[model samples]
Target chain A: MIDVVETTLTWRRLSPRMLVIHPFQEVVRAAPALLGLLVAGSSSGGQGHLWSVAGVALMVVLGMLRWFTTTYRITPEHVQVRRGLLTRKVVTVPRDRVRTVDVTSHVLHRVLGLARVEVGTGTSERRHEGRLKLDALTAAEAARLRVELLHRSPAAPATASTVSPTASPTVSPLAPPAGSTPAAETELARMRPEWVRFGPFTMSGLVTVGVVAGFVSRLVSEGNVDLGRVGPVQETWRWFSAMSLPLEIATVVLVLVVFVSVASTLGYVLAFGNFRLTRHAEGTLHVTRGLLTTRAITIEERRLRGVEVSEPLLLRAVRGARLSAVTTGLRAAQGSQRGGSLLLPPAPRAAAVSVARLVLPSVAGASSAWEASPVTADLTAHGPAALRRRFTRAYGVHALVLAALLALWWWAGLPSWTWLTAAALLPLTALLAADRYRSLGHALTSGYLVTRWGSLARRRVALECDGVIGWNIERSFFQRRARLATLTATTAAGKQGYQVRDVDLTEALRLAAAGTPGLLDPFLVEAQHVS
Target chain B: MDTPTLRSPQHRVSRTAVWYWAARAALGWLVLLAAQVAWLVADSDGSALPVTAHVAGLVVTAVVAVAHVTVMPQWRYRVHRWEATSAAVFTQSGWFKQEWRIAPVSRIQTVDSERGPLEQIFRLANVTVTTASAAGPIKVSGLDRDTAQRLVAELTATAQATAGDAT
Candidate 1:
């Protein structure tokens, strides 16, 4: 291994493959425009080729210019990036302030043996502050930079501080060079092909299928496909009309269910394929997953506050639950739908809980000094008044809708069976309301305040009491009448606020006081007096 | 909940808030009256609409204006309360829908006070306590100038001492 540790504020360029990638991305960006050009050409008898050629040439030039202008430099103190040709811009993130360094390689990047590096500094990512993204870096260099930036061991920091030219490249900060491994390393979770069965139950599959169908139909229509015969909408409508009304609905639902299941299974396999979670001797948990866009997330143990295990209605029916890390650093990474908080994919509730226990030492189950008795059946439910309120609210809403339907029938001469159909759904709504009311509960343990809420996707979060920074109590007109308040525990970690919904006024105050002893005591007195 | 010792009754905002609210209500009423007048003028072509529509609209507007000017101010005053200790800032505000919040000193990321033209006329200001919570900021408005300044000073001092201590 070469010990060529040159430290002279040397600027680095991204992988040369970015030249290819930049143009490819430009092409992707202009695909719709190009298609429009082609359509225009078809209409105007091949005159659109000139515009298409001009557009492609312009995009290629812009891409090349952008690639040439952007460059990043790694200093001992900060990782600085400079870009923009017209207006020069510079951004830097301090080395020690960097909380997480992620290396992700999408299909294209992977194919080119390149990866995108993201450096997070544990600050709110508003306007892209406290973050840096370097695209199209060689996979090896990305890994090296990740280690170099995160390296805080005595040997590396000392050498780095001195700008020592002889700092060995052989020593890896996180991993012990190629052949050997750390003794304390333990595999916490790994993907199992069979676990894909739980994926379809998430109902996320159905949503994705719908999205894809929408996109495809739009694409086909854009391509000038004959919508009258080729469109799935007309075909489905025709088929449904041929069958009995109920039978048609059932068959359509069944088809949708089948499509969703297939899609979900495939998605689960692709996303969680080769998934691995390991705890290292350094007290950092490393997660690596994805078949097409491989991603690696590193979570420091100290930053982990707790865990949130979510059980959606379908997932709960199959006794499956997903676990997420309640941590500070990963919040910025949780962009779009794929939350970076996910600690485990949808798995058995027991397994998820066990993994959660391992991740957050004292905040998962009943095996710690803090949570002597985990919040289970004995959780303090928001009393009978809450139940009544839920029922009244649910039934009131339903009645209003029914009345609207009746008004439409009377005034607009609508069908009468609509009222009956709506009436038939009342009991189901009532049952759900009852279930939601039943699900509302809160408990204050020795060091954590556990709140359980929701019916469809019930979540029981055991937030560390010390993590709670403030309390927000809200009582609407109806709730004030019912002597109820929604108590939200505000914390810097996790979801920012966890609410104990529809709790008794006194009980909510008590919980608030218990969670942060002195902070809410003054408010509690006034509240208690009023009550 | 273990009740804290009663240091003093929760401090109410400046009494001038009533006039402030009344003035705002007057502005709203003026807007409503203008809209009604505009509707009447636009419908002067009056093919079939009755004179009763204008009479009823004017009556409802008068009633709403009266309630907003007379009733809302008193309700708001009664509900608005705020107290700042070394540990935290406790505030209870909102008239019909009561909201009580306790923002700990350590958690306060920023302490700011705002005064608009109307508030300036009343010599009153609104103190906003922002924390790193997604539920938004805790606001204590309608404070006398002196009290607002003192509150901001006290909060800023304590917040500084507890900076970076928030969990």
Candidate 2:
């Protein structure tokens, strides 16, 4: 156990090594600019060198000054961080409000045995004022600070109620502060090398390959390398020019497949290498992963509301799924589809579910509302009108595209085969539309509202009803014509809007009314006779 | 099925809301017109566009400005409805695509009343109710100044009272 000073009031500076580390980080950040200067100087004769030197010097001074001035203190009531010379700002987060203590160590920091710690105050707004970050600290000290900040007494009435009562049996022996014993820690999941097989199944492989190839080509071009002179390029180009059209296309595709597979395998290794999830006695789930720059994310057990299992179309073919925690206080990027809630990388369906159960016990336990196996979960399908709408909308969009393509073919003489291709894709679109309708289902389990939707990348989330704070009902004129409405149950956890789409308006009203009983009663028109 | 009535029917905003929206639309048109005038003047001095092209552009702009100044305010007035109870605030807005939002008092983080220069001249105010939900704040515009102030006060009081442990 690392020795920890228990003083609460005194302000503290991070390890002095931070001064060196911060300046080093600044230099590393300035490397690209320095490289650009070098390139320019070589091209234009020495003017850029002076600017590069000045920029590096200024960054070093600023980094040193920042390190020297910044100080933080964990008082009994709040965690206060005071810094900035010219701006001079103070950020204070109440102790109870601190939700997550994320520790990350870059390759450099790891070599120096230091980690960066960020204390989040649980506010989802991207305001720096609500967060406290310590740029560098010993790995042990980071662990201890995480434990100290997250440690809540089991006897505390407020938090105890949130934790499963059965967990109390294991609580007594684990009461000592973290870093005290390894015996109470339980390893929940670890990365399996075989899971890399699912990496290519995700569309990310092709995207990653394309990105890397583009970047490499750009770099090569900048360095005055003739791409056509490259061995594979020259050979392929010569062969392609000589070959039949179909064979040429096949060869190109084969090369792409090979590149994508290799990139996917590499990406999986970089992301999930040595991935480990463990539950501390203090009820914080620590997830550590990554090969190059290891990241350690701490999630308080109580803040967890539920779990989501997503299976993309390609991944689903092989029974692979990814798990994400639907919890409060987790950072969600503005307008982005994915949040910082990934619990398990794409893996075998069984493995993902097993890990989800371990991380979130309530998801599968006897007292659970949702099923242990989401596959077996009896979800209620929406009305047939919803299916009709999906098909009509899907086909309508495809028809519009086809019409535009036809018009282009008539006006500008586009390839007639392109029209044939578009025509052939209609069946696939119809199949997808049918699958989307089949995927749309919602259920009010004992304590959770489980909604499943999407065709390309389907997500089935079982969000705890208790976590719901509000209910929104929307009916567009088109939806009204179909007597349908979208009901979104707004919860602090997970995506802000989780919709039970294209349900009968009355059904939506009833669901909203039932989710939060008295809250919506005032707004809902009662039936003439109480059923 | 028989048409169902909303148990707590929403209240339409003040009629002055039309004037407020019309003024805002006019202001937007004014800015666009200023830019177009500047562009037309610059084009005339040097690379003058065809007479027909300029006439067509001006005609489209005028038609759009007229439609916006006349039709939009009415549509907005018809679509926008809000209801506040002790438990939640329900706001329904948008014309072409209606949006319905509900924010529970328990999740209320802040309540603010804003009055722009145009709104001030029209004696109208907008009350914004912010929640932790990422859908962003709910703006109930076109309230009488006194009503906006009172609603803000009432919402603040309710928020304080019902503020339990929430993110």
**What interface RMSD do all candidates show, one decimal each?**
4.5, 3.5
Tens-digit lDDT track of model 1 for A208-302: 88776765564454445445665787987787789997898799799899988888877787777898888866566777888998887766666
Cα lDDT tens digits for candidate 2, A1-531: 111224445677877777778778777666555544544445653554566568788978988888778888776567788899899898888778877777888888888888988876556344545667888778877876777678665554344435544433322212344546688688888899899898777666787876667655544433434567779989977867998889888988998888877778787788778988888877878788889878877788888877888999988999999888777766543332133467888889988878876775463334543363433378888889899999999999999989989999999899998888999999999899999999999877655677899999998887777777777777777887787888888776666668899987777776776667777666666456321
Q: Which ranges in model 2 have alpha carbons more than 4 Å from their true place?
A: A1-8, A18-61, A124-128, A155-180, A206-248, A332-339, A361-376, A399-424, A527-531, B1-5, B8-10, B29-61
- For B56-117, candidate 1 gives per-residue lDDT tens digits of 88889989899878998898888888888888788888887888788878788889999999
Best by TM-score: 1
Model 1 misses residue A366 by how many Å? 8.7
Output the worst ten-in-a-row residue range by lDDT, candidate 2 chain A.
A166-175
Clash pairs for candidate 1: none
- RMSD of each candidate? 4.3, 5.5
